[model samples]
Target: MILHRVAKENYNLLYSIGLTGYGVGMVLVPLFAEFLRQAYGWRGGLLIISALMANIIPVGMAIKFESHKNSRQRNGFQSVPSSPQGCNEGTESNSSTSQDTKGDSSDEIGVVRTIANSLRQSDFYMDPVFNVVFGVTFAYNMVWSGWHSFLVPHALQRGISVRNTIIITFAAAIGNTFSRVAAGFLTNSLVKPVTLFLFATILNIAAILCDVYFDNYYAMLVTTCISAMSIGGRSVLNQLVVRDRASPEKFDVAYAVDQLSVGFGLFLGGYLCGMIADHFSSYDATFKLLACIDVIVLLLIVLVRYRPKSNPA
Candidate 1:
């Protein structure tokens, strides 16, 4: 929200950089969890993590910048008539009355009515463009979440030691970081996110398909790093996919809907992967499933590009 407001049209770069915080957290949490586990045990680790999570309340409260409408209302003196003192007094009285009415209207609306009104304003459910972007988010999260969850485990199953598997995970995170930063520049200039995503999808599908054929650790490492870049690239592009179509003022709606897709998709994808793992004798089958999910994402995003919107109703 703050990024959109601050960057306006230059949102892609800053937003993508901001998103690297997640990738950084992914890298940090495993180290933190491992250290905390050895030192504090699982129960104590959970308690500490919960305490850390509580900081979000204060962090969220810190973003108390003025809203667009509030800024305009507060700075509306530019439109004042320069005629006379009486006219100026009248304008001041009317402005005061309007501000008071705003407060009174909010009080009269009640919480439920206010929420309903906010929903009507958001148009999250009704906007067809947003619906497609939302679907893309959901689909991509399904594959990406499953991929992240399984990467280390699958590497372990391939006879890589637990310590070595962590290296592979680290490599993936590095790729993620690199790709996100690169995406910031790319989105601002030469490449359309859709084209970048398509390329990433192809690489991702190929990496998964060829995983079984890797002859050694280096082969697996290279594949994983490159594949991770694609994963990371998609992560950055996902929100930009929505950003390109919506105005900055509508960013909250876009962010909310996009995140709603992410949560649901992550849940559903992880569940499906769990079911697949339970059914199959090998984890390789789950990679195939992830590939198929990416195919669905590809189709959906292609639709996003080509789908007509002559009548947005």
Candidate 2:
């Protein structure tokens, strides 16, 4: 019961954070980008980003402090139901075996055991589909981050106009924003989590090919829309999978693990695409490589199942 309450509380907090952060950030970036360009020329980009970084550092510190507090709570004294709660002292005595007595310190012990307990039973491990959904979400995030960080610069190096690049970017962001809002609504209504994942996989693959096949203004806009839409849809889908599949007690752990994939994806995408785009004179080659990756990841998503374990809810 405590776990269930904690899970619900966490879900509400995280959902609000995601919505507000993405919504406000997206809305502000175009304006900020324009302001920087006007004020500092090309260097405005650097200045604006630096200012944002300045803002982030303090907020990040606060978050780190809170995270430290939570970690301490998780690692320190453990709680159990009292006798009046129907968990008798004798029951605890019976369960506390030699192994429990052998534990070096209550605070230091149970770390491994706790993790094992969380995932030990059929209630803990995710369904096969959940695995695939997580993988696909991770791969797509890498691709999306790669596109945002490197693709436009590559386009400019290949002689694409600055105005067109901005337009493409704006269009993509607009598509993504609408899709994200729509996805939130739909997840509560029409779409099942797994079905949304499948759709996201298809559209994301299509987005990659858009860069490969089309290089002009109109194609850029369309391809950007595809890319943005897929990512937007997948954002909600990924969360839904965790919510549906994970037991309430383990939801936080599961979601945290899933988000680690996003971090790795961002790192890999930046490094890999940066290396490839730099190595090749043409951005076309980079797009082609990413396209291949997209295909492989899409197939993987399709093959993976989405059902949760068949034990207690």
Candidate 3:
């Protein structure tokens, strides 16, 4: 249970480092798409983009997929009960990989088995910790997807110049990339991912409120940057939080489920954004709604964290 937290290499940091590439792509993709749209009409741009994307088929086929048996053998342990009491001695028989890097050495050797015993048996969603991760993922994706889609429109409505809107987008991309790298560098044993998630969500809501209640081009730029940084932290912590709770073997599956939640949130978020705005007759109504959701989701996570465990029957 503990090694998951104190892994020698710090997987979260590595993961955050990798995600910076995605942030870079965020800035680059728009420029590329715009260029394509201009160089060739929209239809031609789509066709070219489609042709370029088809390369993924060959790339996917070229990668050698690992067998499940090999994967289990490599991981060497399953993640069992997450009682915080640590894994039982019965699991002590499983010899885990020796963890050590130049300056790192964790005394705990029993990297407990995964959250789910096997691929077919995934009771992980029932775990309160996983549920907390789920809620955080869902709300973060829903609100952020809406932000990505509507922030430009919202800024234009506030009379921000198109040139300045582009600046805001650049600012956001910079903030997102910088924050992710910062999170990677800053996170350590004492820093908890859930705590980071909470603070990030708070920052996100605060920025949204600032942008909604007040209107100034500079203010929008600053708040958008703040929100982007908040999102960057959430993006980094998303994997870390789940990493803390899931064992090595189950990490792949747990992460897959987390991603599925993100997809669901994206769909629902766009829908809810439109629906709430139409229902409330205010374009900014959805920001307020998502802010409230942020509060509710935060409260639920707090409750889950503190809820007394039912005495094991």
Candidate 4:
């Protein structure tokens, strides 16, 4: 529980780090396609992805940083109440009893009740804001999966050279990394997520316009910049939403459940995007359609009247 203690400042720094890492990898995947095309040819693109699979090293390092003794110490201190001079030793026991009295049970129950009770007791999933966040994240992931699956192939078909495409991809990655770092700092400093979200929407709109109206290398590069901005912003915001929703006691489980959306989103996104790509005469049509979906979702997020709800578990 202490491990999840989030000062606004610390949250900013860590989220920035996460965004930077995600940007670097996302950027590399697209740019590296050129190398795969040149060194091994188009069909071997999947083989080049083994390099990303090797990214476990850096991920392991990040995990180690979070799990370090110094970090753990801070986390531990945050989880436990500070010692007070006049505190009773049995205070914790009494407090637990008091809480139990609110929803005290007489005896052990059946398996179904146990499971239901556990769900009822959890502080994560019982909120409307989290529900909307899940929806937004699901839409974002779907757009991403569809874009990546067909972006490069579509660009190549549209007279974009693999080398130039790679350059655009690299620039986007670099831009995304910097944006993430900036977002981290800003999140700590700012209170209004809506402002940041609005900015991201603008960027998303610009990127989609670039894709729809122009197919040149320069246009693609600019689109990549917009893509980075939108995605990097969304990534950090999602974490903040999850963090703000749960107390330290249930933070870990809440975060875990929130993160499950990513896996589900990616799986669903990939399958749907592939189907669209397979059926369309041109992948550009699919990209444009996805862009429209992004616009609609963005508008919904902007217009929605959502506030975080209480989870009294």
Question: Which candidate leads in lDDT?
Answer: 1
lDDT of 3 at 44: 93
Candidate 3: list runs displaced more than 4 Å.
Answer: 1-8, 33-126, 188-190, 304-313
Candidate 3's residue-wise lDDT over 1-313, tens digit each?
A: 2333235586667767778977798898778889999999889989998998899799767756457777667768565765666666555544333322422333222222342344334435335555667777887788778777778877777778899999999999999998898777667555777677777777888998998898788888999999899887778887677776665556667787889999998899889888887897665787787777777767755654464223324
Question: Which is the winner by TM-score between candidate 2 and candidate 3?
Answer: 3
Prediction-by-prediction clash tally: 0, 2, 5, 0
Q: What digit string (tens of lDDT, one per residue) describes model 4 on residues 182-274?
A: 776776776555457657766786787777688677777788777867776767766665566566556777677667877887788778767
The lDDT for every candidate, in the order shown, is 0.80, 0.67, 0.74, 0.69
What ranking of all candidate models by lDDT puts the best one first? 1, 3, 4, 2
**TM-score, per-candidate, Cα-based:** 0.73, 0.68, 0.70, 0.68
* Tens digits of per-residue lDDT for model 1, 98-176: 7886987678778779788877756454456557778889989998888888888788878888878878888888998
The top-ranked prediction according to TM-score is 1
**Candidate 2 residue-wise lDDT at 71:** 55
> Which parts of model 2 have CA positions greater than 4 angstroms off?
1-24, 30-115, 122-129, 305-308, 311-313
User: Which segments of model 1 are wrong by more than 4 Å?
Assistant: 28-64, 67-129, 213-216, 308-313
Instruction: Tell me the deviation in Å of residue 162 in model 4.
Output: 1.8
